[model samples]
Target: MLQIKHFSLRFSLYGKGLEQRDLEVISSLDVDIKAGELVSIIGSSGSGKSLLAHAVLGILPANAHLSGELYYQGQALTKKALEKLRGREIALIPQSVTYLDPTMKVGKQVMGVRHDAADVEAVFRRYKLPASVMDKYPFELSGGMARRILVSAAVIAGAKLIIADEPTPGLSETLAKEALAHLRELADMGCGVMLITHDITLALEVSDRISIFYSGLTLETALRRDFEDGGRSLRHPYTRALWKALPQNDFSPLPGFQPYAGTVTEQCAFFPRCTMATEECLHPIPMRDLRDGKVRCIHAA
Candidate 1:
């Protein structure tokens, strides 16, 4: 159970002999994860999906700045409180396992999570990881193997919520499927899972609720069935583009480029590339609660 209200993260870049320029990666974004729900966050490459995860976990970079109310299980998370809860209550599986220590054995690294022997072994086996993996170091494992290690570590920490950022990246199709299966299993066991990914296929397969984000804002949120049934019922140019880009029979790619940070005006962010753009698109778009879910675009009702 996590709630982010008006959450925003900003960064500043400095040039030689110049003052720093502010860049907003996520602007007034809000999202919630209920207990035991697996939510998939999908977006193009620069959509700030990872940034949102980092901000929630209190793992954002030093130069960056963040503001907003992040509540966990009805408790407000401040700077100090978040530090204590990050690894224990809120586990993060970063995009890459390449950062895993090469020096330590896998089991040793995992055992460092305040968990019991039985729990660790059970989770490892549930993911179909072998007992032999524990004795090996990071270099000895394959990409999929390392990903599993990270997953194991996250779940073993007794975390109430797990934030996985591109968990299936760099894996083959079969491995990706297996990894998603493992994530679903975690959700089934009462851990709220947030699977942040750019891959539409993986998102659809593993998510209960899918949230489409673009230009640091949530375009739409809907059930997995909404996506499977042609997704045409779901509107929003960016959402349409994403669904079309999926490998399907009637796919028609959306023309033009993805939205960039700070480049968007108060007008419709997708208007430049959206064929449906009209004079009414000049107004600021806000998230409206449709009967099915929430959508930001004015035309997507």
Candidate 2:
């Protein structure tokens, strides 16, 4: 129930000697999540994944300038609209557990301003959180328990769209799978879920579609099935490279690094490292439909 079109984000910062420059962080990012669908955004640490979540929640810093359009449930997500929807119809499961209030009890925090203890208790029970854990402080809960509480808070709020940002980091493999399963369950229950993470293997397990993000741009959006057979069905070269690098695959390390944000131009960002790059790749590349998926590379066929 969310649509992001031609989205771009940049920060205006003062440079040396009274000069100002704009550092573009996200450019031409296009993604859409339908009800009961889970879309995973796979990217590296600096790919602006978390920034997109913040932008959806209207929590970006004041200096940030946003372009293009964002929509929820077929309506434009203007600043005023976001103010009305944030934390009510939309919720964020942040990257850090520190978002929990250290001073507040777990139950109260989940209840939020709604103050519906029964709702909190019901959600806690669904997640298998014991009643005693509610009275405890944040530091008293284990990592998995804390994660369940965060998910519980979103459920209690009746959020229609959940943006889970890097939810599996610092957890054991089992715990990580458990967390992802919960998100999958939510999507099955008619909630739109956006999973922003770097682990492609874990994402492939539960995602209905996968968006390959790099250097703040989405290079490809492919179905989960497209990753089969060494990603031969995948549309973008960057996506295929990622698949080959997986340990279960070729495990071949790609040369060079992703271009740093703000340094990316309209040309293909992967051109520097792409083996098939030609002088034609120096021109602007727009995302296009290809074989039931979307890819940014003009050479994709």
**lDDT string, candidate 1, 1-301, tens digits:** 9988777778988977887888988876767888889999888788899998888888778889888799999989888989899889999988988768889988888878576667668878977888888889999998888989999898788888999998887799999898889889889989999999988877888789888888887778878887776776675667767787776735677767766757778887777888788899897787777756777777776
Residue 232 lDDT, candidate 2, scale 0-100: 90
User: How far off is residue 48 in model 1, in Å?
Assistant: 1.3
Q: Write candidate 2's Cα lDDT for 1-301 as tens digits.
A: 9999989999999989989989999987999999999999999998898999999999999999999989999999999999999999999988888999999999889988975878788889999999888899999999999999999988998999999999999999999999999999999999999999999999999999999899988899999999986689999999999999999999998999998778988678999999989999998789898987799998899
How accurate locally, in lDDT, is each candidate?
0.83, 0.93
Error in Å for residue 36 of model 1 = 1.2
Candidate achieving the largest lDDT: 2
Q: What are the models' TM-scores? A: 0.94, 0.98
- Extract clashing residue pairs from model 1: none
* Root-mean-square deviation of Cα positions for candidate 1 versus the true structure, in angstroms: 1.6
